[model samples]
Target: MDVKIDSEGAFGSAIVTLEAGEKFVSEAGAMHRASPNMDINVESRRKKMKVYGVHLSLSESNVCR
Candidate 1:
């Protein structure tokens, strides 16, 4: 796996090259670009939890909130 960072700053983008069977997990919309061989799965964390009758929402204690 090769990780290449383009530019520099909080708003900088990243280009990742993954070998066969490599897996990469990142925050929502974090991936700027990827190779065609890579398999991309975008999941909604809060939505997936709701399937089991679990509800997750913003909280003051959590920075992501």
Candidate 2:
């Protein structure tokens, strides 16, 4: 997998290239585009984990910017 980030801050858009059978997870709506052969799937986070009900924990800091 290859990652390229474009911007001058801690948060920016990224382009990723994955080889065959590779996998990646992004924020729920982070994906804006993908290659034609890319396989995209949306699955429940809780179901995938099978241990939690529901939870959302997010933290942001400007220290890296």
Candidate 3:
């Protein structure tokens, strides 16, 4: 994988190139565009927490591949 970043002022963009069978992971809403040949998958991870004897579920992160 190859990564290039360009920035102007406070705005920036990244260009990523991937080889076959390689995967890239990023935040769910970070992607602006993708090539037609790229396959994308979104995954969400959740954690179980117990606070004050109460059970709670929280999302850890959203990853895109």
CA lDDT, every model vs. true structure: 0.51, 0.55, 0.56
lDDT of 2 by residue, 5-41 (tens): 8655655688776655556777666666765555566
On lDDT, the leading prediction is 3
Model 2's alpha-carbon lDDT is 0.55
List model 1 lDDT by residue over 1-65, tens digit each: 56687777979876665444555667665655554434455555555454222112222333221
The lowest-lDDT stretch of 10 consecutive residues in candidate 2 is: 54-63
- Candidate 1: residue 18 lDDT (0-100): 49
Per-candidate RMSD, Å: 14.4, 13.4, 11.6
Q: What TM-score would every model get versus the actual structure? A: 0.53, 0.60, 0.61
The clash number for model 2 is 0
What is candidate 2's CA lDDT for residue 60? 32
Tell me the tens digit of each residue's lDDT in model 3 across 1-65. 78888554555778887766666766545677776656666566444742122111112232234
Report the error of model 3 at residue 57, Å.
29
